[model samples]
Target chain A: MSLLEVRNLKHKFRDGTEALRGVSFKVNSGDFIILAGKNGSGKTVLIRHLNGLYIPSEGEIFFEGKPIHKQIKWVRQNIGMVFQDADSQIVSQTVWNDTAFGPENLRLPKADIEKRVSNALLAVGMMELKDHSPHNLSGGEKRKLAIAGILAMDPRIIILDEPFTNLDYTGIIDILGQIVKLHKSGHTIICVTHEIEKVLYHSNRLIIMDRGLIAEDTLPEKGIFNTHKYGITPPMEEREGIEIVRDMTWLK
Target chain B: MAEITVFHFQAGNTLIYRLNTKLKLLLLLIYSFSIYQLSLKGVLFLSAFIFIAVSGTLTKPAGLIRQMKGFIFILILIVAASMTSVTGDPLFTGLPFPTREGLLSGMLAGWRFVMIIILGLIFTTTTRPNQIHAAVGEILKPFPLVNESAIAARMSLTIMFIPILMDMLNEIREARKARYIEGSRNPVKNISTITVPLISGVILRAGETSMAMESRLYSGALPGTKQAVQRKEYLLFAACLVPVVPAFLL
Candidate 1:
């Protein structure tokens, strides 16, 4: 069963610009769906609607069959969104403080907040930078910190918008590895990005959004349109995805 | 306890900085109220405040002076204006501006303003924003209507960001300058462009910060039980009001 359902989602800005036009899609838990679109294609507007960042101008968004509007905060607690800009997502002075933001907002006990913050930082390999000022962090570190902030909330579904932007090869690998880990660990992941190569490697399903509509949705193995080059760079040598873990942690 | 920065508070250990924020807050009120009430005693107290502020400058006098110059100028202006009309007495009233009553009143006003400035600077410079916010949260915990921690956090943010805002303003000014020729002068247009971008930029930055804060779980509440704690500290705080009572009565 789908964990999230968007039925005929439409969003129009106050200036009368229709950013999303009847976009609809769904994903079950543990499914990594890539939302691909060109600039101004309503990728962001559609994702923002899922978390009540912007209410749909029309149609409905459901989290496990429950209407999004009915319980905005509760639904938001289950869905974590990482915006395109790291600067926009990071508000705290320290890295740990920034990571602890979402869980703190959830009014978790102080000790739990601290634990989640540490665990989240550990998950992103940012524990060493916990005390550093977020503004002083490098671009990749800031991205990881942003993800860590969401992870601290322990959201079941993580939505990332252009997660690979401003990242180098190593940074890209680090983040993608974490995304795969998150998906494998039972979290539904919906990422909006045009970087088809990374999406193809990391995502089980692909949902291409064009002008706020789901232009194409298919499994990675289906080879829709033979856009292999457009998809993610396949692993250098696949060992059932075990090499990624070994390479990342240097485990036997 | 004070940091090297003029208005920025230091977080590390220091006896004066470590004193209860509520106590410092009370001292500020008492200090201001005493100066507001005019008598020989009040004048002496105000003079002592000036001396302390002046002595503080010995370590980095220029910083303190630079911080005070704007307020000093305004105070000087107020005193000068009042001096002109202090006609009942001949003390410092020889100029067209000075009168006996106006001179006395202006001097008192000037002294009061200075005292308030010095005390305020000391508190702000010595206290960290986090501590201030935490103290505010602790103090306001009693009132059901207020979320003290959030208020404290916001207070900290305002304290921390004011300088950042000022820096952004300076950047905006510099940007405006670069747009124009070296010797050309168009203050009105220059100010328009400068102010417009500064306001917009600050607003946008503020919106982003608020969103970030909101996303992190800053529901703007003090992060503890709403149940009121024992009233001992509050009682002591209220008791600190004794000094101000006499001033107000007088």
Candidate 2:
């Protein structure tokens, strides 16, 4: 069974802007899916609906065969979102407190909260600086801290919106390593990006959206070549004279 | 700017650091109120005691003095204004300045102001910002209409944002200098260039912050396990009240 199902979902803003028109998709458990599109292509709007941030103007969304609206909180608890701006996502003074913010909202016990926070920080290699101020961290460290905050919630699905935006090359590499690690740990990953070149090699499947509808949904090799038509840049290696080699032997 | 440590909390094992945050908050409030009621002598005694007590916990004693540089100018102004109006025996009997009553009154008033600032520095330096939120939440829990957790969270974010906004202002000032706009004589144009971007940045950041909080499922309060105040904390609270008792009697 699919973990999440969206059926002909549509959304319209109060200002008469049609952001999403009859979008539909299904996400299975343990799948690493990339949602790609250009600016104003409804990629953000579509993911926002999955977590109930925006109500659909029409159609339905289901989680585990049940309607999402009936259990909005549960949907939110299961789907953790890491926003683009790292600084804005930090709502607490210290790293530990900010990471614990999600679990605390769930009203867990003191011991459980501490264990989760410690484990999350350790997973992100931020255990030593747990007591430091989040504002003092570097750009790369801040992004990692944001991911750790979401990890503390222990969600089944992790969504990252423009994770590589405003990051240096080293920062981008750092975040990519973390994302790959999460995918390997059996968390269903859904990353939304207009620049798909950085993450294409890692994603198992690609879903392209254009003008509030799905443009193409297929395997990476086939669908990636069609991304530019919808305003997204395909990977550089796909072009002529750019040799690409990826070993699939390790998977067996 | 480098010397300034706004909202920086020093971790320590001192008596002040170990005390419950709620107790410290109450003590700070009581002490602040008592400052106005106490006589000049009492205020001086309290100021001296606080300085001696908090000195052990401060990492940089000089930083506190550096923060007082702006207030020093106001202190001098108060003394100058008081000297001219006060009537009393003049020093040297011929200089026409330095009246004994004015000198005494000015010193007293200046000391009171300094003492208030010092107490505030001590509170901020020793206590963590999150502890303040927890303390505030615990104190407001009894109010039927109040949502203590949400208010505390807002307070924490506001406090944390101060240093960030200050840094942004500094960056904008530098950017203006880089563009040679800093030397422009027109005040309106210079001010508008900086203010426009700063305000817009703040508004954008505020919207982002709200969305981030909502994504984390922050309804109002931090609903995790609560930490209870210990008996030792109650004892320390009583001990702090001892100093204020004399002010009440007087």
Candidate 3:
């Protein structure tokens, strides 16, 4: 049975702008889903609904067998979201305080909060910088700390919105490796991004949105995400490119 | 406030900054009490109070005094109001105004007001809001009732916003000044002219801040580690109260 499900979900902004128009999808436990789209495609809007940050104007979201609206806190406790901007996500002055934020909310005892915070920090390899202020952290470290903040929450499903937006080459590889480990740990994951070139291979399911609607939903395969469909320039079609090699390995 | 904030806080050192915020706030309480007692000494004590405030870490006391210049005008008006014909003696020796005793008392009241203002300026410049919030949580921790972390978080954010809001107000003023907004003194017209833009700016900034906070997952639980030194710090805070009590009692 699917661990999480969304059916015909829709959202409209207060300004009378329709941001998401009747999107639908589902993921069983341990499934890796990639939500893709162009700018203003409602990808972030859709992911936000999964975490109950925004309620759908239409359709239903189910966690396990329960509807999302009926169990908002329960849903949040299970689904962790990592937003695009690293700076905005951090709430504490110091890295230690930020990591402790999630567990502290849970009202756990001091020892438990300490252990979980330590474990979470260790997971992201940020234990060394625990005393450093979050503002002083490098871009990659900030992103990692943001992820660790969610990991401390111990969510069953982690949804990342444009997680690789500002990362350097090495940072991107490091984060991707962490995401793969998360998947291997039997946690369901959803990664949303417009640039599928980097993360297409890591996902078990691919969802594309266009103009507030789901454009495509499929498995990772060649000829998928073709720029020609969107009326944009196509790739070089270099068969020996790393992208091609990644796609081949991913599909296999 | 911005001028004072820029001058008082050094780039380094947490000795004054690290004490949990609530304790610093309690110190403000002690300072207020001390100032209230000093009112008996009249303007002489008030001048001494200002001297002590200037002696503190604030690098630009003159900037702070300048910020209070507008308030000083208001204080004069208050003193004048108290010295009206029904209440106090007038220095001008008018038929319908101030008794000799009332005029003297009004002057003393104004002096007390200045002392209070300077004390506030000192406290506001010296303390960070986060420490205060944490101190409040520490004080309440024994009960195990409220969510200390959330309270601390809100207090810190609110304190930080005061200076930010002041800057926003100044920006609005500058924008209005560009269009000659200060010509009218009529209250209703002035409010309508200034408030419409201010309210809209506040709403826009508030939405942006909230979105930024939510994106960061601010709704999550508080940190698990209560720094070991917080208890020792609390003792030091209690010690800070010792010096002020005797001063106030005298």
Candidate 4:
């Protein structure tokens, strides 16, 4: 069974705008997916549903063969989401407190929460800054704290929405390295970004959405060239004419 | 309050940092209440003692006091307002400037205010916001008709957002400067030009924050944290009042 299965998911805003028309996909364990599309392409809407952040107006989301809503708490705990804007996602004053938010809300024991928070901070290389105010952190550090907050919940699958937005080149590289490390450590990653050139190589598969529907879902190299047709500037053109998927990274 | 970093938590391993958050909060409330009852000498002695005593734990006292420049201006205003009154005996012949009584009274009031804020700074600086939230929830659990956890969560977020909003306002001002739109001499026009963007930004941020909260499984209830006031915590609490109580009685 797939780790996550979405069938005919549709969402309409209260103002009569259809954000997602009918989207379907399956995420198996250990899949590093890059969900890419142009503006208003339902990429965010789809990921939001997987995390139970939004309820689909129509269709069903099955997590490990169980309906999503029926086990929303489990699904939410399992599918962690790192939002596009890192600042808005910071819910506490201190880094340690922010990392503990999810676990505390989960009502885990005090000892368990502490251990999880420590482990998360350690994973992000932020153990030293754990007690510092979140307000004082650099942009890259804030992004890492957001990831650490999610990691504290110990989710099996992580979803990142526009993770590199507003980041400098160094910030982008810092976050991308963390994401790559998370994937290598066996956490499934579903990342959303128009800036695919930064992380397209790390992704094993690419799912392209357009006009509230999945336009293409295929291997990165096969579907990468077609990104321009869907309004995304192809990474191929941006990488100084580099066509190979393996070389599309800053880590190299 | 706009002096954002002054109130932000700083990492330290002093005695104050190790105190239980709930106990620190209770001590702050108790100490602030006692300040109104303190004589001017008592207030001065207590403030001096605490300032000196907690210097190690306060992390950045000099910076914290430096940001209080705006706050100190208000204190001076209070003193000036007190002096302008005619009820007290004048200190000098020059236009009934400062009355001896007014100066003493104003000094007491100002010191009281500073003592309260300093205590608050110590608490916020040493304690985590989430700890405050959890402590608040635990404290309010016995009250009727109260969503204790929700109130606690709001309190935490409000404290956290103050710095963010200040930063936003600063950025808005900078952007306006960059656009050369800050050339207007009218203060009202200057404020109005920036208010709209700041409000819109806050609204947008609120929407995003709610989404972030939901994604993290915030269900308006915090987990049960261990809040028992230990023996060491009580000793620390008593130790805080050691100098203050003697000053008060004297």
Which model scores highest in lDDT? 4
Q: Each predicted complex: what DockQ?
A: 0.17, 0.39, 0.12, 0.53
Model 1: per-residue Cα lDDT over A44-129, one tens digit each: 88887888777788899889889988987887788898877776686555677668768867878988988999999999999988
Candidate 1 Cα outliers beyond 4 Å, as residue runs: A128-132, A166-181, A184-186, A195-200, A220-252, B1-11, B15-19, B24-131, B141-153, B181-184, B212-250
In the predicted model 2, the residue pairs found to clash are: none
Which stretch of 10 consecutive residues in model 4 chain A shows the poorest summed lDDT? A237-246
DockQ of 2: 0.39
All models, RMSD in angstroms: 7.7, 5.1, 7.6, 3.7
C-alpha lDDT of all candidate models, in order:
0.69, 0.81, 0.68, 0.86
Candidate 2 chain B: worst-modelled 10 consecutive residues by lDDT: B1-10
User: For every model shown, what is its TM-score relative to the native structure?
Assistant: 0.68, 0.82, 0.65, 0.86
Residue B204 of model 1 has an lDDT of 86
Is model 3 an incorrect, acceptable, medium or high docking prediction?
Answer: incorrect
Which digits, one per residue and each the tens of the lDDT, describe model 4 over residues A79-164? 99999889889988888889999998898888899999999999999999887788888889999999999999999999999999
Each model's chain A TM-score: 0.87, 0.93, 0.91, 0.96
The CA lDDT at B85 in model 4 is 69
By DockQ, the best candidate is 4
Q: Which ten-residue region of model 3 chain A has the weakest summed lDDT? A: A243-252
Cα lDDT for residue A235, candidate 3:
32
